[model samples]
Target chain A: AQTVTQSQPEMSVQEAETVTLSCTYDTSESDYYLFWYKQPPSRQMILVIRQEAYKQQNATENRFSVNFQKAAKSFSLKISDSQLGDAAMYFCAYRSRGNDMRFGAGTRLTVKP
Target chain B: DAMVIQNPRYQVTQFGKPVTLSCSQTLNHNVMYWYQQKSSQAPKLLFHYYDKDFNNEADTPDNFQSRRPNTSFCFLDIRSPGLGDAAMYLCATRAGPQETQYFGPGTRLLVL
Candidate 1:
């Protein structure tokens, strides 16, 4: 079975500061994809960034970026200059060559003014 | 414009009543997936349709069923909705298994 884990259940960061959310997955397959999705209060989920397993370079989407270490099966998301809008539930997901997409226990990010 | 759409954003159904949620996509994606998300939890995959083919998750409840009559439309039917079935049902579409998924505003199901 494929599983994704988010170690931090909740994280807090002050405005203009930076915070990182940790994620790791267990997969035997060599080719797959990783994604970070954000779900704001009462809103639909949106993609933040995506990282392919074969790429050695990490993925970045503006202020949102990921430090992906495939050898260790670690994919952590970093939010630089955290904004109030960034406060939401961040979910780390894994998708294999198969169609099934699995999500981790999401990390709730709180931004302080 | 949002490519994916789910109708009746909020639905209330009585216990033991059968309910169906509809999803349509204009993206012409080959794979459409239905996910169930409870309060403060991850979205769980119920089933997905790859074009005309239907794929079910091994642990998906037997009561949950899906249909894809055409390339752009999909439906999820709950044979007998229980209290545990109350959750936000999300519809997503992607070109294929290897593509990024685009999601629609989910339908929140309420079981009474």
Candidate 2:
């Protein structure tokens, strides 16, 4: 069974500062995908970025990036130049070719001005 | 335009009462899914439809049923709402089996 874990329950960052959320997963499959999704107070889940397991290069979208380490099974999200609008619940998800997607508990990000 | 829409953004039902949550997709995706998300918890996949083929999760309760009469819409029916069933219901769609899913705004359900 594949499982994703986000150890941090909550995180805070000063506006314009940077913050990183940690994620790890346990899986045997070599071919897979990882993703980061953000859900604001409106309760809409938005895709932030995605990384393919085979790709050695990390994935980035605008101010969001991921540090994907296949060997260590670590996939962390980095939010740079954070804005007040970035405050939300961020989730790390894993999906293999054969199975349904699995998601972590999620980390609530607070942007303090 | 809302790509994926879940009707009745908020629903309140009494315990043991029957309820139905609706989802419609404008992207015409072949896969449609329903997920349950409790407060501060990750959304859990309850089931999905690949075209007209219905696929239910092994752990899903028998009280929950679904109907997908066509590609653009799917319906989740809870025969008897329970306190444990109170949560937000999310709808998602993918173009195909291996495609990235696009989620709806979600419907918050309150069971009394």
lDDT of 1 by residue, B1-112 (tens): 8799998899999999999999999999999999999988999988888888898988999999999999899999999999999999999999976799988999999999
Candidate 1 pairs with clashing backbones:
none
DockQ of each: 0.81, 0.76
lDDT score at residue B73, model 1, on the 0-100 scale = 95
Candidate 1 lDDT score at position B98: 78
Tens digits of per-residue lDDT for model 1, A71-95: 8999999999999999999999999
Q: Can you tell me which runs of candidate 2 are displaced by over 4 Å? A: none
- Categorize the docking of model 2: medium
Task: State every prediction's TM-score relative to the real structure.
Answer: 0.97, 0.97
Which consecutive 10 residues in model 1 chain A have the weakest lDDT in total?
Answer: A93-102
What lDDT does the true structure give each of the candidates? 0.94, 0.93
- Residue-level error in angstroms, candidate 2, position A63: 0.5
